[model samples]
Target: MKLDIIDLNLSYGSTKVLNGLNMQAKPEITALIGPNATGKSTLLKCVAGILKPTGHILLDGEEILDKRNKELREMISYLPQEIPDLTTLTVMEVVLLGRVNSLSWKVSEEEIDQAYGVLEDLGLDDLAPRPMTELSGGQQQMIYVAQSLVRNPSLLLMDEPTNNLDMQKQLEMFELIKGVTAEKEITTLMVLHDINLASRYADQIVVLRDGKVFCSGPAEEVINEDIIQEVYGVKSTVHFHQDGFPQIVPLCSVRCLPWQKRKDQGLAHQGSVDFGQQN
Candidate 1:
């Protein structure tokens, strides 16, 4: 499936969130990375049809502005940054909510099977009977991701999906998301905070700044240190792995030259003193 954003403009009350934004998303994971308040979430919300934009979005070449709520919801699934507060439902019950948009009155047997499948795929099958409020933060995140995927959408938009996940679970989540998106042939766009993971997993990366796109292209072209510093205002050293994927090492504040500050004081900074060298 293909999703197209055409000069999308969105405003809340008076402030514009997306200013003439444009993008084309396909059946691959696209990472939207930027600093805070840059409207990454706003762009995703607009594309998902949660918020009506001033311009148009095309789903499979059809204008989304003309589509109704159920029609648009069927085509796209959106996972918000914060988990929903549903205390009355079990984990599986909450996941089954993914199908509620299609239900006329009652949930179907097929929907039950689909929800269970999503839970198992997300490693949340064991938590099926637990209350929504009883799960850990990472567990809740996984369940929410499962809830979004249970719909088998044409496009999935995740807003900061790995907010509280540990390092191990984070890797697992990315692997699972990649597998699902590939197997299901669903286009995935997510607001990712981890640049390294985005570089490794996403086929496309879009950088945003001040409600506008700073730069966007393949992850290879957009993951350099220059773009990082330019978009994030922090000095970082970027290194490429053998596979040519980029990894970023954020340095100290951009204000001072630490080496120069040390040298100016004549503190006997010896020649190439490698700390804790075995030799």
Candidate 2:
């Protein structure tokens, strides 16, 4: 699936979140990166049809804004940032719920096989009978990822899919996502905070700043010291690996300098920083 967002706008009461946001996502991983509260998650929700925003969202040249929620849900699988309370549900049950749109009163053998197949692919088949509440946070996060994949969606939207995962697990999860996306030809839009990880895995990176697209391109062109300073207000060194992916080493925030120096440079009030806080 190819997704195109044109002049997208969203607001909450008096504050505007997304303003004339426009981007094109193809059948590959497109990582959205920005500072906190820059409408990264908000854009995901709008695309997922959870929040109605005034804009033109086209899926493969067709408008989806007028589509009903059920229609949209059937076409797109969205994994939200907040994990739901799966207190009594088993892993298999939760995963099967991903097919709720097609499930009958009695689940067919095909649905069961599909659910189990996704769990096995994710290496979570052993946890099928385990209660969700008993699993660790990382385990639960992977299970939700499986739930999103079980639907065989053409378009996948994931918000912070690596949350609560350890270093090794984070790598494993992204590997799975990249592999599945390519094999299935799914258009994936993921919100990620780790710029290096995004650069390494994503085919394209879209940087959001102040509710608009600051820059959009491959990691080689998009991940730079200038973009880091402007979008994140941080001073960083960008190093390129042999494969040409950029790795960011953040030194400090622009506001982390001495007060007098900041004043002299006239950057004291651009962003706040705590002297006692450690990066």
Candidate 3:
């Protein structure tokens, strides 16, 4: 499936968060990368249909704006950033909420099995009986993620899915996401702070900055130092690791060249400033 967003705009009262933003995400993991306050989360909200855009969104040649809530919920599953205060519910019960749109007044065997199955895949089976408050940070995150995956929606949109997780758990979450998306042939889009994770997992990358799209293309095209510097105001070396994905190495401020460091250090040098040894 393909998602085509055309000339989208979003405003927060008086402030404009997104301005004429547009991009397409195909049937693969597409990553949204940008610095803080760049509308990354706002863009995800618009894509997930949580926010009404100024323009239209076409999914597989059909307009999403005309669809009802239940109809929209049938096709897209969204994992929002702010996981609510669900301290009272058990993990299993929370996962069942994702299936609500698919459920009737009575529960079905398939829905129960599907909810349990996804919880297990997300490595939350052991914690199923425990209340959400009893789980650790990573476990809570996994449980929330499981809730999103339970419905098996055709399109999955996530905002900062890997935030506040340990390295091991982050890898585990990535593996589960990769396996499920591949097995179900689902189209997944997510916003991520870690460039390495996005590069390694996402087939496409979109760069957003200051309510506008700096660039939108494959990770290889948009993850370079220039784009990073332009959007993030930082000098970075994007390392292609093992032809799998790109990892970002942010250089130290003292290590940047004269032209690069001048922007931060307020130096007025014209030519290059060699920070290397004078040999």
**lDDT (10s digit) by residue, model 2, range 11-84:** 99989999999999999999999999999999999999888999899999999989998899878999999977
Q: List, residue by residue over 9-37, the lDDT tens digit for candidate 3.
A: 98999999999888888788888888888
What digit string (tens of lDDT, one per residue) describes model 1 on residues 145-234? Answer: 888998889889999999889998899989988999999899999998888899999989989988878898887798877877777888
lDDT-based ranking, best first? 2, 1, 3
Measured on C-alpha atoms, candidate 1 has an lDDT of: 0.86
lDDT of each: 0.86, 0.92, 0.83
Candidate 2 Cα deviation (angstroms), residue 250:
0.2
Off by over 4 Å in 3: 101-105, 253-279
RMSD of each: 7.6, 5.4, 7.4
Pairs clashing in candidate 1?
A: none
- The prediction achieving the highest TM-score against the true structure is 2
List the candidate 1 regions with Cα displacement exceeding 4 Å.
Answer: 102-104, 255-279
State in Å the error of residue 118, model 2: 1.6
lDDT of 3 at 13: 94
Clashes of 1: 0
Ranked by TM-score, the better of candidates 1 and 3 is 1
